[model samples]
Target: MSETADSLIEVLREQCLIQGQNGIKGLSVVFRAMDIDYSKRIVYEELKIALEKFGLLMSENYLRTLFNALDLNDSGGIDFCEFMHKLRPSLKQCRIDVINEAFEKLDVNKDEAIMIDDLQVIYSTNAKQHPKFISGEWTEEQVLRNFLDSIDTPGNPDGKVTREEFMNYYAGVSVTVDDDSYFDLMMRACYGLPIRGS
Candidate 1:
């Protein structure tokens, strides 16, 4: 990881620190809401905090362990070839030719890869909707619930957005996400607009 990547990690570490000051016992919900399990997940945001908590950058093992998961072929080593092959589709879909600082900034949770949670956060934060992103006054549960509700899968009287539903549902309108307003994410989810950005 370079300086930009390190800065991305640092940002996430701070989020964990602020949320988990009471320790893991209290932080579990927030972590799950962010869609990461400490034991199995190895996202950049989580890893950044791990580096801080474990005093990363200073330790070789922590860095090694974080990237070790990318050794999908189990070759005992990871090279550029393998990484590019695996990440090409996602990178393309996300509209990135290379993973750079912008990608890091988009990854609010500090996880290297952007999951649905990360996107939802960015969508909500940038849209400036549902209060939490702007004010940071709600509980983790409240924030997650509000987002899920805002993006609830259509065709149900009560709003319910499951992982399967999120991927499978189609929105009725064409949405240009770069200029998407809060109404854009909200109405798209409610009306089932074809999702554009990740």
Candidate 2:
């Protein structure tokens, strides 16, 4: 990454850490507004306008360079995960371990990606603890689908989630949570994993 890009990422990361969930929410709103096509990926033109919208006036050269740096995949646009990852500080090793453990539990078939089938198996095993299932507002399938949708790549609900998507989703959540143990507990509780001492 260019120094400018790195600096910007640091600034954004610090701001989000200080503001917590509100900072993340504000960034989401900005991304949504900038994605004029609603494709969930910000193209060069869209990014240019977004910069201006935020009162940032950048020369054409600098803007292009920054955009290229953010587009890690060379896919010609920056997806929401990529954008957020750039702005969020790295998670601690403990947080990563817990996240991976939860992901492994969800990836029932040993596939690197979590699919609807995996969700079906896992959710069925834990359905009694699911609020939506207990309240009768959603069937087991509905609960699984909604959970998948919540974490799926933005604007591409393909009914599957890659590990990167899962990590990035939690990266956003990690900023909101200040403590590592709390995050671990949150994941364990949400996924019905046994508590640490148990």
Candidate 3:
């Protein structure tokens, strides 16, 4: 293997040890599955199939963007190292992107802020229906209170959540969750899978 490839494999081995066997085994399975032609690298079409298997169901344009981001050497395909790296920190960012997209959707009035009424409507209408992972283990009231505390400062007591505040709250929560479970949640989010218990 090339030095880069060797380095990438080492990283994957280390991550597997840290994340435990199941996590590493899942990644290995996905990687092998994506290497549909057994070429030891994943091409764009193969990647699309793999993501679909994970329930990502992303648009072609979005997939292209993601593929390009991970194809670091401009190699037209992603090797194991690139794939592992992408699945690591980049997957976390993908989860954040998912959160940001949902937040934008919840900003019903396009006012760049989510009002209490907007939140209430969302919670009432879709919270139970979707049961998003971000809701965590909190009751609706607890989730609402936590969100309010994050955004409603002394100066801004009007019960409105700005995009920044919303993102910050989630980013903070991601770090605070139990390490193993947090990564599991992030992995599920990355794959567009519904998290258990929401």
Top lDDT hit: 2
**Cα displacement (Å) at residue 95, model 3:** 22
Candidate 1 local lDDT, 112-190, one digit each (tens): 4434466566554533555664587775556655655543432121334433323221111112123335434554454
Task: Give the best candidate by TM-score.
Answer: 2
Q: TM-scores of the models, in the given order?
A: 0.21, 0.73, 0.35
Residue-wise C-alpha lDDT for candidate 2, range 101-167, written one tens digit per residue: 8899999998898987998788776755689889998788887888897787654567998887788
Better of 1 and 2 by TM-score: 2
The residue-by-residue lDDT of candidate 3 on 55-118, one tens digit each, is 4466676667667766889899987656654443322655566567767766767898887656
lDDT of 1 at 10: 45
* Candidate 2's TM-score: 0.73
